[model samples]
Target: MEQILETLLFASDEPLTLARLREILTPGTSEPRDDGQDSVAVEIKQALAAIRARYSREDSPVVILEVAEGYQFATNPRYAAWIKKLFKDRTSFRLSQAALETLAIISYRQPITRAEIEEIRGVEVIAALETLLEKNLVRVSGRKETVGRPILYATTPEFLRQFGLRSLQDLPVVDENASQGEEAAPFIPDQGAQNPMAPPATDHQNN
Candidate 1:
């Protein structure tokens, strides 16, 4: 089971959740035992724990991480500088300061409108919204149920993946004492790491 889990984790390009791993491990049957405990789930967790332990050595170059509500292997951030050299020539998606600010607002107060973002930033956000949309980081979730029914924007799963977050709940706590004019700090992805949580190289032009 450990070997199978290791191979699956190594081969997968995205984080694998427990349910996903179970589905792969036991394709056609229910996992609940007569004792009412989920045997497969218990075994999977034990295997994952063992796998994590096996790779927890000080000299290990990689480690298992739980991101986007699943598990995957990523190179240790301590070695990020050396790993970045491998992808130095590849095209990477870069967000402008304006776009990042806009994204931060949307992430914290999502299902928000462009006008709301503008009001907070004290500036128009059309271009920033466009950049976020192009990157698939944010999306038009729906329209606000108000007079004009302005389009509402929300962060996408890609945003969670790119930012290495398990969920919006994983976002850093906001500083309540922060000035009203101050924007939330954007969650930046670790670049050039061979981790599913890291943003992948793209063909799009930098924003």
Candidate 2:
């Protein structure tokens, strides 16, 4: 079972949650009720711990990490220099400047409407939102309890994993005395003065 879990974690591109692991590993089984008792969740936890410990050896080249409440294997940071040279195409995985700005807004003022995001950025975000959606970094959390019940957007677990953040609380702190008490600067792109996540450009790539 431990080995199976480890393999799944290695193969999965996303974090594997405890409930998800339990469902796949011990479906239909009753959950352990008593504290310190044996259960599928407990077993999975212990298995993950063992794998993490094993990879923590000084000679290990990779490490298992629990990010966004799921387990995944990551290259040991010590080998970052070699990995960067080996992964030359990694730049394509990064969000464009526009997408980064919109994502930052969503991350901080989550469950926000498109209107609110645009207001913060002072620019339309249709293109940025689409890119973020296609990447699974943002999700439609729910509808706001406002007059029109506008759809609310929020960052997903994938966002946390991508950013190497544990949770929203891990977001960089802002100075309380800053202007509007906002973060020092938004993720404005270099060409933000001209085009900001322009939808035509993003869509034209598919044509």
Candidate 3:
């Protein structure tokens, strides 16, 4: 069953849920009793915990972590410095000021349309948006219901993982110097938008 879970993790492109693991382990099984479902969920949790422990051993090169309500295997953070140095020149991409601002807009006001973003930034972000999309930091969450169906953008989990955020709320608040005493940037959705997405916008910013 551990092998099964490992295989599922390797094959899954997205986070595999406990219910998903249960389904895979007990194919064609139907709802029997409440007790049965609870028992299975407990088993899966225990199995996942064991797997986590097993991979967290001192010599393990990789470790599994839960993020964005899902589990993924990643290299241990302790080794990140060396890993970065090894690939530093090859992956030495830096965010431009425009790109940074565009990403900030999306991180705060997603699932926001391009028009809405431009309205707030007071400048067209077409090129910066493209760059962010290519970097896998921003993604199209969906299209707005408005006329012309503008595509809404949101930050990806890769954004969170790269930024060392556990979730959107972990994003720091941008204030004072960053926005020049302007309205603290929008960190959540407008009424009727139903988009609960927002990320930290650090208050003490160097950039």
Query: Which candidate number has the best lDDT?
Result: 1
C-alpha TM-score for every candidate: 0.74, 0.65, 0.62
TM-score winner, 1 or 3: 1
Candidate 1 residue lDDT tens string, 129-182? 999999999999999999999999999977887788878988877886898998
> Lowest-lDDT window of 10 residues in candidate 1?
198-207
Candidate 3: give the clashing pairs: 171-200, 172-200, 172-201
- Per-residue lDDT over 1-207 for candidate 3, one digit per residue giving the tens place of the 0 to 100 score: 677777888777666656567777887666423364577767777787677666654335555655554566666554556677678778666999999999988987889998998998899999999999998999999999989998999999878755545578866576636645566645343111121231222222222
Ranking by TM-score: 1, 2, 3
TM-score of predicted model 3?
Answer: 0.62
Lowest lDDT sum, 10 consecutive residues, model 2, at: 198-207
Q: Cα lDDT of model 2 overall?
A: 0.74
Q: What is the C-alpha lDDT of each candidate?
A: 0.80, 0.74, 0.69
The alpha-carbon root-mean-square deviation between model 3 and the true structure, to one decimal in Å, is: 10.0
Model 3 misplaced stretches (Cα beyond 4 Å): 10-14, 30-37, 57-59, 85-89, 147-149, 156-207
